[model samples]
Target: MIQTVNGKIDAKDLGITMCHEHFIIDLSKVRGEDDSTLQDTKLMLKEVEKLKALGCQAVVEVTANDMGRDVIKLREISKAAGLHIIASTGFYLAPYHPKWLQESTIEDLKALFKKEITEGIEGTGIKAGIIGEVATSKNKILQTEEKVLRAAARASKELDCAVSTHCDMGTMGNEQVELMLSEGAHPDKLILGHIDLVSDILYHKGILEKGVNLAFDTIGKTKYLTDEKRADHLFALLDAGYEDHLLLSQDVSRKSYLCSYGGKGYTAVLGYFIDLLKERGISKPQLDKMLIHNPARILDRAC
Candidate 1:
């Protein structure tokens, strides 16, 4: 299991957590730039150390099958960086991927994912740290796409890792969650990531009603709606009485892992969010529940 940045790990120990963020993700999109994609541990450690010092106890590094998710490297880097690392399993953006058609069934992909977790990923006896931060394109949900998600849901049910996904522009979260629920996945084990990009309050509420975790964190990118708005959304969700179901994070990564992102990455998401919340008048206990108790529970973790 990957350790937390501050060395306190366990479901309950993932305090002030960010549910789904990438530590270092280099997709095939960065193909033929192998040297550029490979991360330098010493440099990455600087960021990790900063996060640890800043109070980022844990982060779920969700680099999927196609999106440059590296369990071994993440484990090694996290250990050196002194952070507890949680890794994601599964594939990326089904519509954008050609392999979407290759799998005859999501069950097949589930088998592969299960094998990875149960047996080992890439020959490392270490299983995936989490089920997935799976993805699909905007309004382009295909038949197989639903199937793969359902399979992932089943796998998450079987394996006990948190299952999450990226949402499309509008109404996708609602559709996606319905699909997963139809397939027998527990709503409690699900995380609806990327709600910021998805623009619909009704859609967000609809998904939240399904008992799935609604993560409305897209901070650190000033170009985003604004911390005030992000705060508004978080509090609105909380005020709407869903605070227990929310999670937060920036999704930032070290520049080398991602060719883009000027690397204005977080040494500590917990530190940043706390400051933002306080400036916005959020109480200490309220903030604590959102970042600490809530995330631990949502991870379906008793630890």
Candidate 2:
């Protein structure tokens, strides 16, 4: 097995591990916070220290192929910061694409992602260690999205990398999973991000049955749903026996949408998620299982 300093995990392990969270994401022209790219290595180290203080041993920085996924920079900064930083390879949201989106194909996208995981990322000197935060191109999980996800799903299976996605707001995960499964990607290697918006236990349960990992990634963004509602749903999901297929995180990256009014923006997103679990009557031991044990299993598998 591909073991780490820790042991194993599914999605949840109360000694909780955050599966997808961004310390900083470089959206090129779309600016938020200060410039936290490679130039701000000290700041990055400081931030990782905070996560460590909170007991986060690792963080998967699933920045996309077209976005600010600087693998060389990520390795240097994460190493200095003493965090097990795992980077990913895949496409991003449509808006973030360059002018070449008009001509890209499944093979083209796959070749680029393969190069990153194999050769290197943009010749930056550090290679991508994982697969995604892969988002589909379709408005819903349709043909275009399916094409990208199919390539990504297949690539992940071949490379033994985990695949995650930036899902549409209204529970588009069902369609997303359809593509991954169709492409022979084991659902265990796929994480459906943004499922908190699904709002139906039966809907999520059905999706979980397909065996893809579930990501409760938007934990601290309480404006859309109350903290109570988010916690209740999450706790209920844990109780629903899908624990092995879950991933916990605060998708606390700056995208103008989440930055209108905030402190350091991503700061305290982890803390907020942790506190909500406490308020919901979830004990510390259980929290560790969801956050810690399960995530380890998901990442270290098939090594």
Candidate 3:
């Protein structure tokens, strides 16, 4: 079964899933930019409806607790949009880590993640469906970030939940994978996000060769890399027969990326990039594995 903001559902029902996204988040505190906040529920609803129209049935909301994760708002959006929204439980990069986190041990962080995943998030009775967006810094994993990653891995292993992670600028993915697996998290259950931005096929293959999953998630953010190049790298992976280890998403975190704000928004993957992949010779079955089968397999839990 796959846990969603609404409740558990059969994995087969999670069709055309976007593996990383954010809704009703407030990153202004950490980002220090007003545009970093996405608080307008009505605007978010409109964008989500566009995604629904594009055939995206679900989204793995990877907004971490310190990144202003509002599960109550996520529940409202899930109900209003009628999209299966899987909320996350974990801390983000070092800058977003809260003050209390510095004092917390790895075991303390693990217990917190387990409680949020199994019981409820902050007593709201809306449990998180995954443990993620837990992150590492660019080219390096900070000490505090290491603690969060270790704890996330432990919680994921114990609860049998997938742990999606942030690989800043797509760097340090190998390190992230090695650390998480060393902590006993299953490689298949670990999704390293933002990998598409790196533009390194060998780096991607290196992570996949380790038996972990890779989220080619930053699909439409052209400032980092073009969709054309993203497709090329993805095609290379598929050609190498790693389709089952990949996932796709736009990682649409900022309001500037939202259609309501004149950007590609949540529909970037299903609405545009899928066609790009097809044009680059990514077959229908390979697309299905990345979009439908792979996400369902990773997100499914014993519950």
Candidate 4:
């Protein structure tokens, strides 16, 4: 079964999933930028409706506790938009981490994550369905970030939950995988995010060869990398027979990325990039594997 904000459902029921995304988040306080905040529910619902119309059934909402995670708002959006929203339980990068983290041990962090997944978050009864976007810094994993990663891995192992992660600017994926695996996380249950930003097929292939999943999640962020190049690299992986190990999403965490702000919003992958892939000779089965099959396989928890 796969846990969602509403409740657990059969994995097969999670159709056309986006592996990474954020809805109703506020990063203004941390980033000191107003555009990073996505607080308007009506505006968010408008964007989510567009995604639903484009055939998106669910989204893995990876906003961690330090990143203004509001499970209540997520539940509201999930119900209003009629989409399956999987809420996350974990910390983000060091800068965004809460004050208590420095004093916390690995066991302390692990217990908190477990409680959120199995019981509920902050006594609200809205349990987290996944253990991530637990993150590492760019080119280096900080000491506190390492503790969070190890704790997230151990919690995921204990509860049979999947872990989604943030690889800053697509760096340190291999190191993150090594640390998590060392803490007993199953490779298949681990997803390394933002790898599409790296632009190196060999780097991507190396991570996949380790038997873990890759999220080409920053789909519409043309400022970082063009969608055309993303397609080219994605096709390379699919051609190499790693189709089942890939997942796709937009990682739309900012208000500027929303259609309401003249951005592509959550539908960029389904509305735009999928066509780019199809034109690049990616077949229907390969698309299905990334969109439906791989997500279901990764998100489903063992009963």
Best by lDDT: 4
Q: How many backbone clashes does candidate 1 have?
A: 8
**For residues 9-42, what per-residue lDDT tens digits would candidate 1 score against the true structure?**
5665556566777766664364445533435556
Off by over 4 Å in 1: 1-9, 28-38, 95-101, 169-171, 253-263, 301-303
Clashing pairs in 1: 3-84, 4-83, 4-84, 5-83, 5-84, 12-303, 51-267, 63-69
Clashing residue pair totals per candidate (backbone < 3 A): 8, 27, 0, 0
lDDT for each residue of candidate 3 in 1-303, tens digit (9 for 90 to 100): 999989899999999999999987888986789888987788999999999999999999999998888988898999988999999999999988988998999999999999998899998989899998999988999989999999999998998899999999999999999899999999999999998899889989999999999998998899989989988898889889999999999988888899988999998899988988777678888999999999999999997
TM-score for each prediction?
Answer: 0.85, 0.82, 0.98, 0.98
Model 1: lowest-lDDT 10 consecutive positions: 1-10
Q: Which ten residues in a row have the lowest lDDT in candidate 3?
A: 275-284
The TM-score that candidate 1 achieves is: 0.85
Q: Which residue runs of candidate 2 sit more than 4 Å off their true CA positions? A: 1-16, 28-39, 137-139, 142-144, 255-272, 283-285, 301-303
Superposed Cα deviation of residue 46, candidate 1 (Å): 1.3
lDDT of 3 at 44: 92
Query: What are the per-residue Cα lDDT tens digits for candidate 4 across 1-303?
Result: 988999898999999999999997778887899888887788889999999999999999999988888999999999999999999999999988888899999999999999999899999998899998999999999999999999999998898889999999999999999999999999999999999999999999999999999999999999999999999898889889899899999999888888988889998899989988888788899999999999999889864
lDDT, candidate 2, 40-142, per-residue tens: 4555666567667776767777777766766666676666766666677777666656667546787777777777766667766456656777775435654
Residue 295, model 2: lDDT of 66
